[model samples]
Target: MANSVFGITDENGNFTIELPSWLHATPNLEKACAVKVIQLPLDSVCRLRHGPSSSHGIHLSSSEDGFRTYTTGWIQLQQHDTK
Candidate 1:
């Protein structure tokens, strides 16, 4: 399957996550999934610790075919401050 996760960063430095294909295959699809988004400060070591963290991103995990699949998407930081 070509399940994928996408992330979009807004002008305010916030992020929006796009559901995977498998999760939205049906009109009333309900599958277990996990999403994580972390905002890193500019020029911070936190990014290194997190392996090049993005200003906006998403992490997704779902069960499929007796196995779990994970996907991620990274978005560049916006100029405007969201906080």
Candidate 2:
């Protein structure tokens, strides 16, 4: 199984996620597996809601409680990018 990496967005609403270097060096994810954005939040302190779901890999959902916009995206190996 692939190890999971986690990152929180900075004050500028930017986040950086890094995978094991071995993945690229060994090419373990070339075509056998895909890098995906987990749709579900593993752990959250505040209220959370499931927003709009993506048919492809990208997930665009909204926070109905505050009407705030929450965006999530995912990518699959050998697949076209989706917005």
RMSD of each: 11.0, 14.9
Off by over 4 Å in 2: 25-46, 51-83
Model 1 worst lDDT run, 10 consecutive residues: 49-58
TM-scores for all candidates: the values are: 0.27, 0.31
Question: In angstroms, what RMSD does candidate 2 have relative to the true structure?
Answer: 14.9
Question: Can you write out model 1's per-residue Cα lDDT over 16-83, one digit (the tens) per residue?
Answer: 55565566554423234433444456653433333343232324357677543444444333344345
lDDT for position 17 in model 2: 58
Please report how far candidate 1 places residue 63 from its true position, in Å. Answer: 22
Best by TM-score: 2
lDDT of 1: 0.45
Per-residue lDDT of 1-83 in model 2, one digit per residue for the tens? 34656566554434555656665443323333333334433443322233323222323255366333323453222322346
